[model samples]
Target: MLMNPRVLVIIPAFNEASNIESTVRAVVDAGYDYIVINDGSKDSTLDICRLNGINVLDLSQNLGIGGAVQAGHKYARHYGYDIDVQVDGDGQHDPKFIPLLVDEIVNGADLAIGSRFLSSTDGFKSTYLRRVGIKWLSFWLQLFTGRSIKDPTSGFRASGCRAIKLFCENYPDDYPEPESIATSLKAGLTVSEVPVRMRERQGGVSSIGGFSSVYYMIKVSLAISIACLTKRS
Candidate 1:
């Protein structure tokens, strides 16, 4: 057993055979406890995680992004981890930045969001609609929180127990990372964003690679807006 895993890294992987092992190794190398939530991947994802002896949480059925993340939160709470750092399965989030986020959280922030737009060295890629979507929600987010969030939708975020409790109890079922940020702020959690770089994917075209990308943008954007309206300020 690892000693007092203060930061619990949650990787919600769906068919990440090509990158899961490397990601788990990186988290181990970073010296933080991690849980790989295998969301019913049909590929070798679960096998690879098991072979590596990584801490894992398996689901009988695919629960989408929110469910996978909530599983990690429950595990962390049960195990008594103080913080939860969510890293994507496809290698988009760099493991090297884990310490920066953890340090910020330890210093008192309830959530440390790794923002690609906060520093001069970082960058963002995607279609015009996605960019527009980020900007549109970001506008309302700032208005609601009275703080300008450098990256509202980045999956590379770290949350503490207080924030994790809120999420596991009433998190949005889809496209949750962005919506959770707002919820975190409204619930009086201190949220900060630091500069971080992203890597390209390693295997399998994104489930949203084709025309589904447009549909994802529309759906998530609407979900974010609606969730914001109903959440308490």
Candidate 2:
């Protein structure tokens, strides 16, 4: 019944009051339909969204990234959106690359990840320690899924019809980006990485920083391994 694929940009915000408005505006200015999932921030994020007339879904409690993103996917699926793109609310993800990711999905990829390391562009590539962790995880992910994702932890990704449905049914919780990729590959979905230039967060603190980076590497690596093994069954 539809002539064109409907795209929904999902922005999961938690205590991103300082950056939510600008992030949402970028998506709006890019001319894509979007929904902001307010992940129970104790700040004025919800008020800002309301004041700016941004479309948002208010969660009763904090659901973390996975839960908030899943909520958006479920909404997209329910509304018959043909594509779902995730742009983080921390202002790290650039909206200009949305079309490129969507193009990959339209062509054939079920999941298209916007990879920061795939190209030789001068972009914000996180800290050195985090990059090391990402590469280590990437090696393990290739071992498990046979896919060489340059940026396994990239939250800037787009999912097509199949992936949107699959994720809505079984999405990972906690730190989910890498685990979600493993899950997709194990489920026989086509996953590809497209080069993208990301920026440093314009405002607010990152969830993973300092000593927490060590914890992130361990936890996400374990989660990816578990997702692959479980989905392999």
Candidate 3:
């Protein structure tokens, strides 16, 4: 192993004022450094972070989830972090599973995704429609990369140095989680999935809701297909 690797937990928040403090506290309790990207939330997200004395990157305007996450990767690369873990600010991801993701990276995975379907113990598997969309994405990802991922759409993930560098250079701007996996594999990096328990969001609404799920499915499917055909850098 990676004896005492420098790990940074990147939490991207947008209008998650009600949940940011507890989320940061969970990461801190887990004994890891973390930074919250306040993606132009009109709510009191930034204020809560500041009040809690949490490290935060305050963006002036909304950049969506992908852009916010890309910013986190850039910070991880710039600050020389050995591992970067993406944890949602909505409290759905358990910080306890962070160590599992890090362990996979230590074992030589360039990217480690926290998968809910890897085991029966995972508390939540998301909505029925969401699960259907996730399964569709999983099929496409497997067909393209020749690798099967149980939770391709999971936001809770960790990236090694190589993966961080790749994302810093070029990251997907919309619906990134699944596409990023394909991109990393195409770039010849090792990716793995570790079983992790997840929970329903404690607060705030989902970014993808109602009919948007259909649009999200179509968009991410097309993106993965195109990514598979494109030549790797």
Which structure among the candidates has the greatest lDDT?
3
Highest TM-score model number: 3
Local accuracy of candidate 3 as per-residue lDDT tens digits, 80-176 = 9999999999999999999999999999999999999997894989999889889989999999889999899999999999999999987888889
Poorly placed runs, candidate 1 (over 4 Å): 1-5, 122-129, 231-233
Worst 10 residues of 3 by lDDT: 224-233
- Taken over the whole model, the C-alpha lDDT of each candidate is 0.81, 0.92, 0.93
Q: For model 1, how does the per-residue alpha-carbon lDDT over 141-189 read when each residue is reduced to its tens digit?
A: 7776577886787889888778888877877667777778877777788
Per residue, candidate 2 scores C-alpha lDDT tens digits across 1-233 of 22368999999999999999999999999999999999999999999999989999999999988999999999999999999999999999999999899999988999999999987999999988889888998998998878789999999999999999999999987888999998888888999999999999999988888787878888888887878777343
Ranking 1 against 2 by lDDT, winner: 2
> What ordering of candidates by lDDT runs from best to worst?
3, 2, 1
lDDT accuracy of residue 174 in candidate 1: 76
